[model samples]
Target: MASEKTNGEQEMPKKKKNRNEELKLHDLLNDVVSPILFPEPTNSAPLLHRIKTSLSRNAPLIPQASRNTARDTLLWTRAGSPLRPLLLISVGTITILALTGLLVFTLLFLFATINVVIVSLLISLAAAAGCLAIFFACVTVIYIAALLVAIFAISTVIFWTIVAITITTAWIGFFYTVWLVTRKSLGFAKQSLSVTSSAISTYSAAWGTRNLKHD
Candidate 1:
């Protein structure tokens, strides 16, 4: 019985020591890791300062003349005058055409590069092996003929001719096309608004008749 009491006494202190240690660990975690993950007010002030500093570091350094030009451009675009729409349409059309031309040229160059490599390989094979010379020569001629046909097909189209035409013709056609489309769109919009107004008037008249009968 005495030995059993002594063992129980020893276990009680150990339990107390373990509870104290756990409490200290919890306090330490709350002080260190908790502040990092969900920062305290004191830490948040420094974080905001750091963010401001980073944004300042990355901000652009625009020159005064460039800034004034950008401001003027924005103002002109927003003034809602005839010149504004004309300027916007012209810029957008030119940008689209330039991008399209660039894409076409890029694809053409890629294909041309591949064709050159294949032709060179064939030519090398023909030179090295006597049996392939006639085959390579015929292939070369066919390739040249195909390129000519492609160029002829492209240049023959009216739309394609616009690319080679003088700037005056291109710009005039661009404005004419835009004007036609705009007029069509405005006519459609007017018709839609008239139809909507008619429908609403009919609805209101029907509702008034029903309400009068009930009264």
Candidate 2:
């Protein structure tokens, strides 16, 4: 009975140690892989709802000082955001009115300036046209004078050419007449010599034959 009691006491401690070891192993495995095998449940709620729940959950822990500061910041942001849009609208309205006034003033000024300058521009244009007409008239007169000079020069050249041709023709005719008279005189002299020679020869022959017959 004593040994059995001692054995049971020892076995009890051994069982407790083994059970503790198994429990420690199970806890380690759960810590390493529990999120992979079994994830935490997710709440499918709107952002505002989630934020409200989170604020409610943490509200008891947040101090009164932090809450007061948060309230003040929210109030300032609400007030400032509304003022910004009003200010921007007023600035845009002022800028549009200033630009419209400037455009109207510029148009009125341009119209007045054009009305003042148009008559002077027309008078200057007329003066330019008259100057151009005078210049063209002078050029036309010069062209006519040059044409007259050219015609006179051509007529003088033609008259001198005719005179030179007449003088040349007269010289040619005088030379031709002299040559004809010389040729006729030379032919007449040759015929007279031939006739004189023939007559003398016949007279000498007749005188010799009469002398021989008389002898």
- State the lDDT of candidate 1 residue by residue for 1-215, as single tens digits: 99999999999999965744444323433444444456556664565665554445323322333455556667778886555656566565655666665566567657866886898788886797776877777887787687666645543553453444446555776787799789999999999999999999999999999999999
- lDDT of every model, 2 decimals: 0.65, 0.59
Q: lDDT (0-100) at residue 182 of candidate 2?
A: 88
Q: Whole-model lDDT, candidate 2?
A: 0.59
Q: Estimated TM-score per prediction?
A: 0.36, 0.37
Q: How high a TM-score does candidate 2 get?
A: 0.37
Give lDDT for model 1: 0.65
- Among these predictions, the greatest lDDT belongs to 1
